[model samples]
Target: MTKLTGRLDDDRRTLVLTRQFDVPAEQLWTDFTDPDRLERWFGAWTGDPASGQVMLTMNAEAESVPAVPCRILHCDRPRRLSVTVTDSFGTWQLAIGFDEDEGSTRLTLRHEEVDLQTVPEVGPGWEWYLDRLTAAVAGEAPPTLEDFVDTYAPMGQDYAVMISGS
Candidate 1:
């Protein structure tokens, strides 16, 4: 299970999730920034990142999926990455931070300026994705979507109550 926290930043709501791995920061950074490595877990991206934009395909769902346009907002190599992703659903302001301590790396993912109404779906979605990354890094099979729906779906109520401050 993952622990997600909600807070306000600059009057905007933010949801954060963190995971710790017994891996070096450099390796974790590569897993995030390297296109090939990213494909193993999340999705593949085309176009040069230096150009500030890329078309990302979420290949985990369908073999032939439309690519989404992602604009890089802030990038600090091996440390932080911030981007705005526009897809069919909506625009997502996402950021990931990597911190290494005592030979372990802690990955923090922040979904910023999010609508409180979407917390139920958005929170578990990230938990599933991060678990996928964890599996990829461990060289294990990724969790099936069915597994996520069965296990993490109910946690949405918890997230709702949390963000609602009730």
Candidate 2:
């Protein structure tokens, strides 16, 4: 498994997360865009994945949150995707960029226009979910939310401090 870390770009109000996968860019893109494939890792989504609104029900065993409504902003197959997500907390933008090197794929997930105060929670959540994606891609069972949260909770403090410069 690869180390999960995110770069905080205060100036841009973005949290940039990166991951390198042994699979091709197209495979990674399918994991994200195809609802069936997405359900294997990330939340299950309904509606047109290419363009338009979608509803996502996050798959979790404990502390499950409500389904979020998202609007697809851009979709350039196997390359880039942008969406606006809205939930009880608020609305935010998420962008994913994929680059292929040889047969491997590098994914850059950017959470844009974010409220820095939420870093402690959001950072760890993304880390766990992304790791689940990695596991799914590797044909392994996804970890339960309890396990993921327990393992990643401590890292939230590190991310908070990094983003706060304190």
TM-score of each: 0.90, 0.91
Q: What residue runs in model 2 are displaced by over 4 Å at the alpha carbon?
A: 1-4, 10-12, 61-64
Give lDDT tens digits, candidate 2, residues 1-166.
3244987875748988988999999999999888889989877888776558889877663768788888999989889999998988889899999999999999999999878888888888788888889889999988776666578777888887877687
lDDT of 1 by residue, 88-133 (tens): 8899999999999988999999998898899888888888888889
What are the lDDT figures for the candidates, one per model?
0.84, 0.84
Pairs in steric clash, model 2: none
lDDT of the structure predicted as candidate 1: 0.84
Candidate 2, after superposition: displacement of residue 52 in Å?
1.7
The C-alpha stretches of model 1 lying farther than 4 A from their native spots are 1-12, 62-64
> What TM value does model 2 have?
0.91
